[model samples]
Target chain A: MSDKEEREISRIKEVESTNLARDDIRELVIETKKAVEKDNDLLANKIHRSFLDNNIKSFDIVGAIGAGKTALLEKIAEKLTAKFRMLVICGDITTRVDADRIEKYNAETIQINTGRECALNAYHIHQIIKNKDLQNYDVIFIENVGNLICPSEFVLGTDKRIIVVSITEGEWVVEKHPMLFKMSDIAVINKIDLKERLGTNVEKMIADAKNINPEIEVITTSAKTGENIDKLLELMGF
Target chain B: MKEELTKIEEIIANPNEIKISNIQELMEALFAKLKNRVDNYIGDYPTFIEPVYLEENVKIGDDVLLGPNVYIGANSEIPNYVEISNTIIFDNVKIGENFKLENCIVAKNSSFNFKNLNMKNSVLIGAANLKTELQNIGF
Candidate 1:
């Protein structure tokens, strides 16, 4: 077997051991959504293999309108721009504001104007970039449209999935949106700089997240303060 | 957090979620069913006839008749004048008033309004509300 295939096999085994041997139906749903990106598993798997074949790392950053998805990506780009050639795809309802902001950080930025659609679709992603030569980029970050629900159901065939939830959104968010948390590989509880003033229960949100998906890794950071952004980068293996 | 689900991605990844015709009977025949869990809203419990299972944080409303192989999950609210038998409900279910269910399976995070009517042996679910959940983002 090729190196990637062996790595993929081991990864699947690791996931099965941790996730499948329990009554965690939510975890099951997470795994289910991986292949079945809205009943287009065939296409989703093809997209998955293409990324793997090219040896490129892709992540879909999901969050709300003001949850700091773009800010966090900008922070990462600043620190790792020289180390890893990166591509940032910003999805928005109409504006290219986010894409413009990220481009200033020296990482290549592509703006996807979703128009009236609330989220990004996997087929659209594949079709839009099929002709582009992705060889120069080692990592690609696709910042999803700024809504929590519309993006949860679609698996964009990325290597990893990250969800950003801010303290400003409140404590109940982690528990309220089990679907998002369950499907995510990492949860970034952003905007910690405002914690003291907001006085929201960050611990409760972390606890709720751990309770929902034991396999999910949680990171607390404030992109504005530059606090723990290095930790996030280290966690992301940059 | 920011997000969205595509049309194809809206299709259920789990085969069990497929709404087969006669799912109620299929549930009985195969002994396969859903167990609803709750953590958000709750209700009052007025009565339990026999062999009822209630999970942690379950709330039931007044004048509700339950039990005899009925299971109401955690954080689930069964409103007033509701009767259930031989059914399994999953978590965070928001139920309506004046309803009746028998030998049925209700999925998690399901909320609907049904009054003075009976539902039996069916698999019912409402898609996860990512739209409303945007509230948690303070959007």
Candidate 2:
């Protein structure tokens, strides 16, 4: 082989050995750049190529139990369906009943009864979607088993990892789980309508969240009243 | 007959064990057992094993390493240099080249589609789940 081919081969081998190497990130940025200079949107193309290339686009909505994630997800799912074929994966440890609630949307839904484990791992999530005809839908919403800690550790092949926080969950929550916010592409503040009664400082919350993840997009909404729902939908790439 | 014999052995092994109050719990136990068996089987399953297991309709590329308990349904075209271990890939799906997947799926590409987690069309770098939503919602 020529010198160039040898170098490429050796680079691939090195990449394979250190799967978490920064070179992969560098390559991703380079591809994004190429797609950009060619008069095309790299992010959009990457989003679409993500399907053709990786075959996985999983995202999880994580928050504390009272963050109103279920209602927020219901609202988001409604908007998500208008632009993209959507499936709502409801997670609970005991019942298949959660799937029933989301089935009315007429989208495929899966109930991951994690049993004793609070979090759903990548392996189990993979098993659940292996037989899905992916061309049928555009987005998949994984409503993680409601907990702040365990679900953060597993990667389920999502295109984006999002965190859902309600204003009432308190200010310290942002400072507490810096890594979860670091991993998320977006952070959603739900139940904004309750900000007054709950004394939630939106500015403080946003500031704290941004301090943890500078580039993270934060959307405030009230699923109960459908306030700022459209903006949330738009941010979700609807 | 062998399957039937094992069934009988399980019956005899636990005569009064059918009263579990939780179906999910029971399934979890069964799944764990199956996963353990798959883990051990991969260590000893034949290296010459075929990529397409059914009687017909399977296409696979060269230098692919497929481990035990891997299920590739009919009409699935998995391209070259893909490593699938303990995965269930469905039919009529086109898996790209140089993909490394273990305990994962080309889900959404399957017939038994559900709302479970989908890792399709995305690459995961190093990340961890966090305990709070405030970690990254601002700015």
Candidate 3:
């Protein structure tokens, strides 16, 4: 073989050899949790203080996978972008899907790809806000990794915590993830467009959230059609 | 069979799922959701995996790797040296050369007109007249 061909062959081999058999994602979740102690939790407070000082409104959105977090954010950005200086710090385990989606509707996006952790904690925000000119944007939306349980435990230095659940997730979604509801300032029951055919109990879902956190405001929306989005923004103090 | 396919799709949601999702099927569903009854084929055959929907006015360039469940909407452009799989590209969008995209939904009127970009598992949308940068992974 020619020298160039030999070099290419060795390069391919080198790339293949680096593909290690890592632990499963589930195991990685548990391993990541071991580090989320009091000290780690306090890191978010630091970021929160900075946001407060800068007068930046931070909204942390947490939800189940496919619960329409990105869709909802898109709607919000579409409606409020002309009136607000908005940006989204979108988190995912591997890809920049949420960030990319939100960016479509006139909002700037910062894609945070969490390597193995199931959630975005204050530490992640602490690291992210370090470089941002915090004054450029008045409102920041922190779209947490699409997860119900793990994301609830992490305070992402946001002013308000919003948990989104879709009727597509089934009737028991709110009841099942009570802690997420408890931690949230508002609960969004999304995808009402599919509710009629799916026959999901929307009222029951609202009751579930109300029972868990009486202070939590509940809004039913179809992010697809922009239904009740204005009401959501109004409640969010847009 | 659909239920089995759906179970595979659930794997795509959970990062910790043991099995891989059937991406090709899901891409098909996404395209069918927004498909219009119009011809979109406007290019010579690159490599296309079975069952893709190219919406009206869609254009493909040479040496492209297209896969199943892929949908290119009307008035969109997929240039040469591009590899796409399990993706949904909406209307009025543009693509560039040496691009590799998978498991992504490119929203309407977006521009990915950049060279040598690699994006996977993304939902891309942006304003018109906006240019995209290429992010090359690995050394």
Candidate 4:
């Protein structure tokens, strides 16, 4: 017999030796198919129409862990709470730490524990707004789970999608996760206060992001030191 | 000191006069002493349900069932029809209606209001003020 046929026979034999059943494999396949078949554009359009109907501006913030996403949101919430009615939906694998921190700024907050999900999808946002009175807020911010890879694949239906990356994550972060930058409307290079100490070339990182999508708006800020936060708000048309 | 020594040569040769028969005997004695110390340390180790301690101000509503390895801290409120198993709840927690929790840790000052939700092997930290009508949600 052919070598490939022999290998396939051995693989089938190995599967038969294990306790894994055919029904388990079938269920996994069905679940995976459903997840892969989710339509992003349709959900995005629905979310956009919902926001337009309610006269609310929404933004989705995505980033890797320790990328200063929550810090940036906290800074923005603090600066804008006086003028705008804001609501924050913090998405995490577990814990409501970000939502609790944002609550100090006196904005209404909802914490969505995604459990094992890596990224927050449009369905999550839809569920949050399905029953609530959307007209109660002027702006909504959905802070996606701390991830750079999976969040790019799921569009959570927002007016603007911002990806935050820190200079401390090394120089190659933008280059490594180029898909996130390409899908994002704006890229925020955070933690500029440590730029000199870490010897990170911020200009090069910005150039890499621009290379992915030349039309993307790039803003640099240090959330800790409150640098260029007003400029970021201005870019968002606040 | 001479009586303490098993051999006169040991007392003469060793200045400290702490004589052992050999290195093997000394190791066995050391290990035996350590085992005894550890056993004594763990003699009063409490089981899951034995010697349960509940704070005076803790409020437990009707029809609440707590399984093994469950600890409810001070001022925590377990409302009606809630079941908890293998869970550790800290102070000031307020659990609302008809929720099932297993192998979970609920942090301090958190409040949850949901029905028919099952959470297992989850660690919920910080304050949560949630109100939802959950159905068949398992985590």
What is the C-alpha local distance difference test score of each model? 0.70, 0.57, 0.73, 0.71
Output candidate 4 Cα RMSD: 21.4
The TM-score obtained by model 2 is 0.50
The predicted structure with the larger lDDT, 1 or 3, is 3
**Model 4 TM-score relative to the real fold:** 0.58
Residue pairs of candidate 3 with colliding backbone atoms? A104-B125, B28-B69
Measured by DockQ, the strongest candidate is 2
**DockQ for each numbered candidate:** 0.01, 0.03, 0.02, 0.01
Mark the regions of model 3 whose C-alpha exceeds 4 Å error after superposition: A1-35, B1-139
State in Å the error of residue A165, model 3: 0.4
Window of ten residues with lowest summed lDDT in model 2 chain A = A39-48
Candidates by DockQ, descending order:
2, 3, 4, 1
Clashing pairs in 4: none
Could you give the fnat of all candidates in order?
0.00, 0.00, 0.00, 0.00
Tens-digit lDDT string for candidate 3 (A147-171): 8998867787788999999999999
- Writing each residue's lDDT as its tens digit, candidate 1 over A143-217 gives 988988989767788888899999999999889889989999999999999999999999999999999999999
Number of the top candidate by lDDT?
3
lDDT, residue A123, model 1: 57
Candidate 4 residue lDDT tens string, B31-64 = 2332211000011121111112344466765545
